[model samples]
Target: MIHNKYFSEEQIKTRKQQMSSQWDTVLKTNEAVLIHSGEPIQKPGGLDSTYPFLPHPAYFWLTLRRRETEILLYSKDLGWIEFHKEISNEEIFWEGEKNDILISSQGKNINSLENFLENHRFSRIFHLGQAKDASPEAFELKTLLDKTRRKKDASEVSFIRHIAEIANSGYQKITSVLQPGMTERELQIAYESEIFRNGAHTVPYETIVGSGSNSAILHALPSQKIIKENEFVLVDAGADIFDYCVDVTRTFYSSGEMSSQHKDLYSIVLKAYHECVAMSKAGVFWRDVHIHSAKVITEGLLQLGILKGNLSDLIEKEIVSLFYSHGVGHLVGLRVRDTGQEENLNPKTYFGARLRVDLELEENHLITVEPGCYFMPAILESAYQQKKFYDDINWTELKKWYDIGGVRIEDNILIKNDGNENLTNCIAKTEY
Candidate 1:
């Protein structure tokens, strides 16, 4: 089906040209822009071994390539230029052929930047990547980049759909092999193998495989803990073919039918996922969607006796944060947990601090509608101490449900003016 990677050189060049127009609007007579493909870090205590390298999101947005230490430069005069680190015969021998997603960017040697930097010395540079003192402040330019990134281009939408299909294969693998006594790590291997085997260029992030009580620990690495009977196994995983991304999470019952209690918790999260996804049309505020998910979850919790309070008060007090922590989801594309230029949204807003992307939902935006309900010990404990909202929670009732751990069902959503699309809905939540 030709889905491993889809960005062609021509498409990348077209994207670059679009960026050039944006750059032209910002860069003055002598100003330039330098976006960096970041350097790889050597593994600690290992002299030569290094972790896998994924370029800076900004740099990858322009080049769609994954070479380290490369630079994409833009100026009104020079237009678009890529500077590849001059390679050595030793590097060529060890690394073999420098094959990458081909781009027609005929760039200069990194050393040539010495002459260019000295000659044109930009009046005010707009930098979008790292490395020290590379350019001037990039406040306005970054805003342009972030605003542009919020909406997926046509090719970006196509690639995300393809990756979601690949990721579903992995989810199916885990669901099929689920049995008692298997360690979480073993399940992770089964899931990862299928994705890579099915042609995912890489996993967008660490594949999470948490079963039983461990599932409450969001983003935990798969462990050796044995999977007991029919407990919940929560997996948050996705695929990356050329860094085209999808972040999907599905919680599964280890064996046959789940218990009624387990079913209730799962259903709550499932309902929240549905409600949030349905709310993802253009012009809706993303934060309002998050609150809507919280309301749905709080309603479920109230029914289950885990929480007891007025719906509005429960949501406003962040009482739902006790059970459903973390933002419903964030923008997922060129990078997982995208480094959104959305400013410091991460202020301890209690929906688990890292929740950033909160722009008004717009057409063509790709986001994740991942509302979760967990019986996390840490969150429950802290909320108990918040005396003001103390009476609202049913702390004692939560004890009975702690063993179910957590339940999260996520899907990538493509926002539209009329409606929204659930890109990963094929990775089913029930009756599989």
Candidate 2:
């Protein structure tokens, strides 16, 4: 385990340096740009979460450092500017204020929140209000920053790998205690407990614990349903550390039977998943990876008698979408679906092409390579009865394993110069 370090001023300053470098990429090119500490979240009333309350991630990313109720703006003309609430004497008496204490883990010297940006002069400074009035503030600083944050730097990559490490530890705890009689929620709690017990401030997203047929649902949430014997369980979960995240999914047997059907499906999914992961090299078109995965899915479905048509015709028509509708995967980082341009592949050709921005992989980009095949009885019945692509399917055998649910192989990856790095390797998503 890495030694835990609390937020300190030095760390804040170091992170600030990194943020400055990241901001330079976009801001340096524009004639005049405003880098803003994001607006505060609204509380129950009209009040905003301020000085003592936690600032949102966008706020943190731009400022590179902050305390409750503080805002910072940056531009070439106005080096670095700050804004804060005016601490009235009456307010101080009502709530004891510690003026000298370090506000951030980084030892940013203390200052009155109200006095940070009092006399700054920009052609126009950003304000936290409706978009109509601010002519000069045309673009949202947060949106622009989101686009910039898609790819991780070395430090951000380390943070994501650290999150994956913690998730692996949680996976270990669940493995030791997994059994048939346990409810899905029971398993979920156990998994989340381990995540929080470690350094994770929050989970990357909701934890999914789909057992048996529930696995067929692509994005199943954990419920109180009990797992059964001779059933396959699928779990997709992740953790967030310092705002960076890692997502992973695994399927296992409650009875540990390792059925032939289960093994066969696992093998196919793993094949498609790994093939896509291996294709994540610099300069490779993102659509090519999805095409490769689709081809593998087509061949696997043919072997299983799920699809029956001219292979080329079927692939061209996207007949395999019935079983594999989602994309190969998405970019991963600070946000589970981190920010980047949604311009990787053409939107019309790829089902979820919007998720594939920057399709040609770049060095240090992180992505998720998840490929899945599901036998959804509802989709099958509706499409088959209507003859909607029915000519492309072998209905008989597919119905035989209809209750067997689905299989998805997912992993978080780092796109490298020559190849890729699998960050979620330790999270154990499958028997493989």
Top lDDT hit: 1
Q: Taking the candidates one at a time, how many backbone clashes does each contain?
A: 0, 16
Q: What is the C-alpha RMSD of each candidate to the true structure, in Å?
A: 2.6, 4.9
Q: Which regions of candidate 2 deviate over 4 angstroms?
A: 1-56, 64-69, 84-121, 124-148, 340-346, 349-358, 383-386, 429-432
- Give the lowest summed-lDDT range of ten residues in model 1: 345-354
Q: Which pairs in model 1 have colliding backbones? A: none
Candidate 2 per-residue lDDT over residues 259-365, each given as its tens digit: 88888887888899878888898778777888788889888888777778677777777777777888787777866777645333356455333334536777877
* TM-score for all models, in order of appearance: 0.92, 0.80
Model 2 gets an lDDT of 0.69
RMSD of 2: 4.9
Over all chains combined, what TM-score does candidate 2 have? 0.80
Report lDDT (CA) for all predictions.
0.79, 0.69
